[model samples]
Target: MGAGIAAAGLSAVNWEKMLQIAASWIISPVLGGIIAAGFLWFIKVKIIYRDNKITAAKTWVPVLVGIMGGVFTSYLVLKGFKTLIKLNFSTALSVGFVAGVAIWLVMIPIVRGQAKGLENRNKSLKKLFSIPLIASAALLSFAHGANDVANAVGPLAAIVQATKSGDYGSAVTIPLWVMVIGAAGISFGLFLFGPKLIRVVGSQITKLNPMRAYCVALSAAVTVIVASWLGLPVSSTHIAVGAVFGVPKLIRVVGSQITKLNPMRAYCVALSAAVTVIVASWLGLPVSSTHIAVGAVFGVGFFREWDAVRRARRQRSEIVAPLAMPKEERRRRKLVRRSHVMTILAAWIITVPAAALLSAAIFWIIQLSMR
Candidate 1:
C-alpha cells in the first residue's frame, strides 16, 4: 500500500510540471512584449518627445523596432539556455551573473570605438544621432529579457517540475503560463514605473545628443548581449547606468574637452543600488531594477548640478553675470542640480521595496492557492 501511494504521488507531480511549462510558453513572451511596447510608447509621447516634433517621430520608430528585437532576442536566449546548459537554477543564476559582468567589462573598448566612429561622421550631428542608441537599447532589452525573464518564471517552473517528478526540487521545466505571468509582471513594471526612471536616464544624467545617446544605448546593449550569451544574469539597470556614465567618461578622455563629468554622483547612485541588491538578496527579498537604474541617473544629475552651482558662485564672486550661459546649457545644468537628485533619489528608495513586497505577496498568494 505504501509503495502504491508513493507511485501515485510521483505521477501526479510529473503531470503538474508538464502542465505548468505548457502554460508558460503560451503566455509570457506575448505579455512581456505588449507591456514593454505600451510603456515605451508612453515614455516617448509623454516625456522624451513631449514637444519635439522631429525627434519624437524618429524616437518612436526606433523604440518600437527595438522592443520587438528585444523580445525576439529574449526568446532565443531563454530557449537556448533550456536546450544547452541544463544546469540547476542556482548554478545557472550564478553563471549568468558572472557572465554579465565580464561582458560589460569587455565591451567598454567597443563602445569607445563606436563613439569615435560617430564623432568622425559629423561633429554637429554627433549629438543628435540617436539611431545607435535605440539599437543598443534594443539589444540590452533583449539580453535583459533573456536572463531576468527567468526570475519571473523560475519558481513556477520549479513547481511544475516538482509536481511532475514526484520530488520537491528547485530545477523544473518552465511552463508557458508561468512564462506569461513573469513576462506580464515585467511589462507591467515597465509601463507603470519605468517612465520616471527613463526620464531621469534619457535626459538628466547628461545632455545626450542623439549621437551620444545612441552610443550609450548601443554600448549598454552590447554589454548585456555578450553577458547573456555567456549565460550571465547581469542587471540591465547596471548595464544601462554604466553605459550612461561610461560614455561621458569616454568623451572626456577621448575628446579631451573639459566638459564637466560628474563621477562622484554617478558612483554614489550606482553604489547605493548595488548595495541594496546585495542586502536584499542576503535578506531573501527581491530588489527592483527600476530603483537602481533611477538612483544612478539621479546621482549623475546631482553631481553635475553641484558642479554647476559652484561655477555660478565663482562667477558671482568675479562680478560676472552667472546667468549669462546659453539657455540650453543652463537648462542642462539645472536638470542636474542637487534638488532634482534628491527628488529622484526619494523615488528610487520607494520603488524597490514597494514593488518587491508586492511581487512577493502576490507570489505567496498564488502558491497558497495552488496548494
Candidate 2:
C-alpha cells in the first residue's frame, strides 16, 4: 500500500515510523515474555510455593488485584478514553495509584472471604485467580480492539482523506463512523470465525490453567498499554502468544541451562544494560541492546563454569555440579508445543511480505480499472 501510494504521488512513506513499527514487532513480544515470566515468578514465590497457600492467597491476591486495577485505570485515562478526556501521564499515574489503593482496601475482605473454605492446593488457588483472570481477559480484549481496529480501518481512512483533499499527509483524522464500522466488522468477523483459532490457541498449543491464563491476559494488556504509550504498533496476538510461552519452564531453561541467576546477578544485568543504553544515547548512538544483555548472560555463565573447572583442576578437587533434571521428566514437564511454535513462526514470517504484495497488486488493479 505504501509502495502504491508513493508510486502515484499520493503520500510520502514515513520509513522512520515503519522502522519503529518493525522494531516494535520484535520488542513487544520479548517485553511481554519478560513481564509475564517476572509476574508469574513473583506469584509463585509469594503465593503458589507457600506452605499455607490459603493464607498467602488471602494476603497477596488483593495486592495483585490492586496492581491490575491501577494499570487498567491509568491506561484508560491515558489512552482508552482519550477522545472523551485528556490527561497527562503524571496525573493519570496519580489517579491510578489512588484507585489502586482503594481497590486494595476493598479486595482485602473479598480475598479473605474467598479463601475461607479453600484448601492449601494449587487447584483451590485457581478460584482466587478466576475473577482477576476474567477482568484481565476483558481488558486485553478492549486493548486489542483499540489497537488492532486502527490497523483494519487505517488504510480506508487514508484513502478517504486522499480522495477528498488529494493531500495524503502522514496524519489524518479518522471519522467516528469509520471507527464504528471497523469495530463492528471486527466483532462480526470474530463472532463468525474466531472459535477455531481460539481452540487452537487456547487448548491445542498449550493447556492453560486459570493461573497461566491470568498471566497471559494481564501480560498482553500491559504490553499493549506500554506499546501505545511509546507510539509503537504491536500485535496483541504476538504479545499473548509470547506471554503463553513465558512460563516457568522458560525461566528454568534460561537459569539452569544458559546461566544461573540469583537476584543480585539479575539486578546487575538489568542495571548494566540500562547504563549501557544511557551512555550510548548520550554519545548519540541508536542501539537496540537486548542482544547485548543476552550475550552478557551467556558470557557470565560460561566464564563462571570455566573458572570453577580451572580452580577444581588446580586444586585436584571436584567442581560443584549444576542442577540437573532428567530428560524424560523435562520432556513431560514442557509447557509449549514445539510444532505449534514452528507453525506460528512460519506464519509470522510469511504474512507481512505476502500481505504487502497482495495489497500492492490490488491497488494496481484498482488504478488500472479506473484508468
Each model's number of backbone clashes?
A: 31, 0
Residue runs of model 1 more than 4 Å from their true location after superposition: 1-123, 180-201, 204-206, 215-292, 295-335, 347-371
True-structure Cα RMSD, model 1: 15.8
Best by lDDT: 2
What is the per-residue lDDT of model 2 for residues 1-371, given as tens digits with 9 covering 90 to 100? Answer: 44565366445556676576556545543544454455555666787679998899888878876877777787778766788999887998899899989999999988888888787887788777767666665655665565667667887899888998998787898888889998998798567545543433334333444554455455555555555555555442332322344433333333334334433223222322222222222222222232222322333333334444544445553444544545664554444445544544554455455555666777777778999
For candidate 2, the lDDT comes to 0.54
TM-score of each: 0.40, 0.73
**What local lDDT does model 2 show for residue 171?**
83
lDDT of 1: 0.40
Model 2, stretches more than 4 Å misplaced? 2-12, 81-85, 235-326
Candidate with the greatest TM-score versus the true structure: 2
Question: In model 1, what lDDT does residue 127 have?
Answer: 31
